[model samples]
Target: MKSFWCEQAWLPDGIASRVLVRADRGTITSVSTVDTIPLGCERLYGVVLPGFANAHSHAFHRALRGRTHSDGGTFWTWRDRMYAVAERLTPESYLHLARAVYAEMAIAGVTAVGEFHYLHNGGNEMGEALRQAAVDAGIRLTLLDACYLAGGIGQPVTGVQERFSDGTGERWAARVAELREDGNTRVGAAIHSVRAVPRETLSLVAGAFPDRPLHVHLSEQPAENEACLAAYGLTPTELLHEAGALTARTTAVHATHLSTKDIGLLGSAGTGACFCPTTEADLADGIGPARELRDAGSPLSLGSDQHAVIDPLLEARGLEHGERLRTGERGRFTPADLVAALTNHAAVGWPEAGRIEVGAPADLVAIGLDSVRTTGCAADQVVLAATASDVAVVVSGGKVVARNGVHETLGDVGKLLKAVV
Candidate 1:
């Protein structure tokens, strides 16, 4: 059992002062107001929000961060470089790299991450490495094992693409069934994209893991939509809808390039949209219709895809910034809405998390208001004013995993990343 006293906490009702939270075995037991701090209770100053959930991530891409920005190149060119790195990663090497990457996320206030893993190398070794990595980092993980069976529409697997394919959807499902989940991990399903998975196999992958969360790489580029439309005579969104892949349990990773009808199809089906604002911008992927998707019944979530940046606070801020730039209006999404998206654990199969109420996971992120970036900001509006540097203390599953931008158990995250990358 453990107790924490927050100077100010973002409770479900509203921000409360002098709040006390109790936890036992990593689940929040009780929450109430307190006049004074009790002995042995950890004191957390500033505003304490629920730990951020990175709804979309590619753990191995952390290595491609600053290395791909030298020459101006298109997303296709970036893929060649990414594939080069993917081909060289062994299970042992990936375990070390992913551990540092996840530890980096921990210090940035992410308590759970949804890893869109496709670098299987035709087995579950890489998947097992990711599971162990998350356990060592003291954060929850949802491995969205992807099904990749083609190089492109009507194209055969070639070069490094051969490493990603499992011959057929049946083979993909059989291998995925071998991946067992533990207390710190959940196994989920992903369709690599309309380009990788053919029309015939889409439905099989969609229904393969009916009880778990489903994620997919939506139209992040205009070329992808062009190819999908030319090949199937339908938009990628339409293709997914035809396959019965759009559902409340499904999340579209980068709904960037979409037709009006495409948006309608996704929105009407109660699917979720996960916008990676940093990665979208970094990779030259256009800003997605975030506001429209939200109003269309699709819940919104945020992620630091590709690890161009791993700060959920920045992603939350970028989400609003992108909307404002697209619509020529400010406050497209209120701070509360941004916070909701930042801590949307349900998008990653952890529906019981991302809230401060009892019965949720005991995940808390204390953001210091005194930081230079957030000196005069209101507690509720800190999502716009602060960055990951303001995260003073992080508690995941009732344990202090990071303090003041440094991982508790791993010490200097920079050193860890340096040793691996």
Candidate 2:
């Protein structure tokens, strides 16, 4: 029995006004753009939009944002530094770190997150710690419990990365199932990449998790592509397709070095590409043909991978910005497209149905039209000009987790980060 009205709203098509939205049992019960605000309903005077869904995230990586940029190196060198951070995490430490990081996402107006987690072997306590962290942070997590058995296509984990492996594919599935949730979090599956997971292991993961979401890191590096081609005589995309992992529920993260045929396969299979713009740009992972993928009818989503950047507005802008840089064009997507990716398409990575329509979860954000980045801006300007700091209110599943520019879980984050990171 919760209801609210916004002065302006982002409907499926365009900027709308006088939107009367009702919620019951956390689902959006009704919506009307032409209706007047109810006399006693809670109302927010700003441009209200659907909450952003982060299709991919590594919560613990938020600790490594500034530390990884000093050396101009490939993803391998970055992995060394990343490994150092991953090695130091105990379950308690991870929970503490993740709680803070998820709060930051809430403030950024990201309601649900798909965490591609692989740091598994600190023991059973580590599993408990990750689960608690997701709950404390208020993000409905799809803990894509990853099967990372090898260092490359043919090599086993040799050093710090060994902890990410769960010994065998059977053990990996057991561990993934143990990281479950019935209420808040939805546990999902992940193959760290074709490099980290062998061909037999790929089929094992797919066979274990039938009719569920599967995510994998694909073609993010030239080395990975070269290694995959050398090992399998096929591109990473083809290897995956050959293993029968390409499906509508499958999500390919950082799909940068794909061929035209690979793109066509992904489009035809109805698989989604999750673009982690800032992380890809920071790592020099090459531009993903997002515009090409979109034109091919592949659904595109966004993620704040590696926590190099946490702003969905900035992520949306990065999508357009990358397009403009490639084509020398302005406004690659209308505001509606930007909003849809953040809201609807990104939701494909999660369990909940997204939209302001009936039976959809009440995950929404109310942007402050009067904020510094929003001054003299309409709903379109919010996407074009605003940052995460401009997000004023965040509501998820009929619960208010963030309000008035602050999240309920914001305190102690700076302190928790300083100790572990």
lDDT per residue, candidate 2, 1-421, as tens digits? 8887878877666668888888888788898875556787767678888778888888888888888766687888888888888888887788878888888888788888888888886445665666677677676777777888998878879887788887789988876766556666776788889998998878888667875678888899998989988888999899889888888888889889999999998888887888888888998888888878877767878899899989998988898888898889987887777777777534334545557666778777888878777899866668888888788778887667787656766554456567656
Which runs in model 2 stand beyond 4 Å of their true positions? 33-40, 122-124, 345-352, 409-420
What TM-score does model 2 achieve against the real structure? Answer: 0.94
Clashing pairs in 2: none
TM-score of each: 0.99, 0.94
Cα RMSD of all models vs. native, in order, equals: 0.6, 2.1
Best by lDDT: 1
